[model samples]
Target chain A: MEAFITYTLFAMLVATALAAVQLNRLFAVVMLSGVFSLLSAVLFVVLDAPDVAFTEAAVGAGISTVLMLGTLALTSRTEKSSSRSSAIPLLVVIVTGIVLVYGTLDMPNFGSANTPANTHIAAQFIEKTPHQIDVPNIVTAILASYRGYDTLGEVVVVFTAGIGVLLLIGRLGRRGERQKQIGRGE
Target chain B: MFVVAAIAVIVAMLLVLVRLYAGPTLYDRVLAVNVFGTHTVLLIGVVGFLTGRPDFLDIALLYALINFVGTIAVLKYFRYRAIGDVSASSVKREKAR
Candidate 1:
């Protein structure tokens, strides 16, 4: 029964993602993307990671979809694929997929109890985290304590991306204004 | 069973990638990329379960948050730029008249 539920959730995730891609209208695509996120949140619940599920439900289904819609309204709705060729991006994607597949070939069997991942720092932290951090959730303990620096770095990256976007758009605005003024003077 | 599910998710991810590659507008590409990001979050969670390392859910959560913020920033950029373009074009129209 549990296996059935897990499989169902997984199927939903795939279906929603495919819908996001197959849809032509940008609005529909973004909405389907939210559905995908919700499906993933359910999958996380099935996997016993309530915290992760909560974040996915909130960020993925909630905020991300909203932001993408905002972007859609500001930009063109349908992609103009007729003008350009699809060769370059296709090649890049294929190479990336091939490399990832090759890397996965050497990975331990799925759910194997004795995999190297289970024997390394991950296992040690999972075992000792509750005692050291007094957190019931071992994942939270490791994220907030042992590997906190990585999370900080991730936040910094977000900050950088935000600043980058601001600069890009800011410059575009100034350029547009200058162009307008020149048109008026002429 | 989980393996089959993983395959389905991977196929979906491929479809999203195709959309990203073939997307006609920048907005379409961004939409597909957002979908891709969400799938990645799910993929991480499911793979962690499949690999028997539930702890990796932490990273997935972090990813979900960051992806949200990144999407918002991009959207904000688009909005700001679009308004500027519209005003500039209007000014051009007046000058031409």
Candidate 2:
């Protein structure tokens, strides 16, 4: 059953990604990217990594879509067609895909009990989390408490991004003027 | 049962992806994205139940909120060329009406 679900989602994900790559319409590409993210989030959940799935769902499907649309507003709606063939980029993608598939061959089966991911530090964290953090969700416990510094760093990175976007867009000046014009338009 | 449900959601997702890729209009892709987001929420909820990890519901809820905000932002950007003026524009439209 799990295998069936996994295969189906993976196939759809690949199809969407390939379609996104072939598309000339930037809007369609952006939307397909959002679809790609959501599918991966589902795949993450099927693989028993709900925390990762959650982050992917929120960041990938949510924030990235908004950010992309913002970028689209500043750019062309459709891709600017180039006279050059996509052969080189296609070759690079095929080579990278082959290497990645080769690398995955040695990885343990997903959800196997004795896989390194399940047996290594994961066991210790899962074992100690119940007592140390007293959280029902070990993933959250590990992320919020045990790995506090890492999470803080992530927050800092996001903060920097917010500041950078505001500076680049000059929201206070441009957005304010636009808002006034829009207000008068009515 | 969870497996079957997941499969169903994935199939629906594939159908949405087809429309997203063949979009004749921008709205079609946006609509596809919205539908895909809803499927992801359902898939997460079902998968969580299958794995006996109800705690993931919180994450699913978060996805729901984020998805809503994302769709709104995208639509706003498309219409106004800016997300920040959503409220101002809506208010103006109401006054004009």
Candidate 3:
């Protein structure tokens, strides 16, 4: 049943991605990208990665969609027709997809207890987390304590992104001040 | 059990994606994106139950809050070219900054 859900969600994700590429309206493309993000967050939840799912939903479906629309506000809503042929890009994408699939062929089966990922590191974390942190939730313990540095890094990245957006767009509420500044940035 | 619900949501998402891809106007795409966000919130809640980790409800709640703010920002930016548009009276307040 789990495999069925995973396969079904993955198939829909691919279909959405392909349709996003084929679409010409920039507005639609932005919206489709949000759909793709939301779908991936769902897939992550199905895969038992709620932390990842949370972050994906927050950044991908929420913030990224807003950012894309901000970009559209500055640029043309209609995608410009490219006189160049798309065949090369299409071929490249297909080749990359094939390579990715072939690479996944050798990976351990999902949720197998004997998988290296489950054996080498995860086992230690699971066992030690209870004793070390005494946290009821293992995932939270690992993220907040054992993997503290990595989580901190992610926080810093998010902080920097907010800063970058502010610098680029300034405060939107200061519209009059911005207008006095000549407003050609868009 | 949860698989059935997840499948239904996935199907709905795909149908919304069709509207997003064939959008004749900006509003259509925005609506599609909004619906997709709501579906995602549902998917998270259901998947959390299926996986037996009900604590994941926090994630769904967070998604809902952020999704609302993001959608408002998108619409505001699209309409006024700024998320927090300053009004005539508010313009006087800017001098304090």
The best candidate by lDDT is 2
Per-residue accuracy of model 3 over B1-97 as CA lDDT, tens digit each: 8878877987887788777777777888888887878887887777777767778778788877877887788777665564444355444544554
Interface RMSD for each of the candidates: 9.7, 1.5, 1.8
Residue pairs with colliding backbones in model 2 are none
Candidate 1: RMSD over Cα atoms?
9.5
Any runs in candidate 2 off by more than 4 Å, and if so which? A126-186, B1-5, B49-55, B86-97
Docking tier of model 1: it is: incorrect
In what order do the candidates fall by DockQ, top score first? 2, 3, 1
A179 in model 1: Cα distance from truth in Å?
Answer: 14
Q: After best superposition, candidate 3 residue A136: deviation in angstroms?
A: 9.2
Give one clash count per candidate, in the order shown. 3, 0, 0
Off-target runs (Cα >4 Å) in candidate 3 are: A127-186, B1-7, B50-53, B84-97
lDDT of 1 by residue, B1-97 (tens): 6667766776787677566646667687667757766776777667777777667777677667766765665565455434123465555755686
Chain B TM-score in each of the candidates: 0.80, 0.83, 0.81
Candidate with better lDDT, 1 vs 3: 3
- Write candidate 2's Cα lDDT for B1-97 as tens digits: 8778877877887788777877778888788888888887887788777767767777778877877888888887766676554566456775686
Candidate 3 residue lDDT tens string, A51-140: 788888887887788777766765678888889998999899899999999999999888889988777888888778878999999888
Rank by lDDT (best first): 2, 3, 1
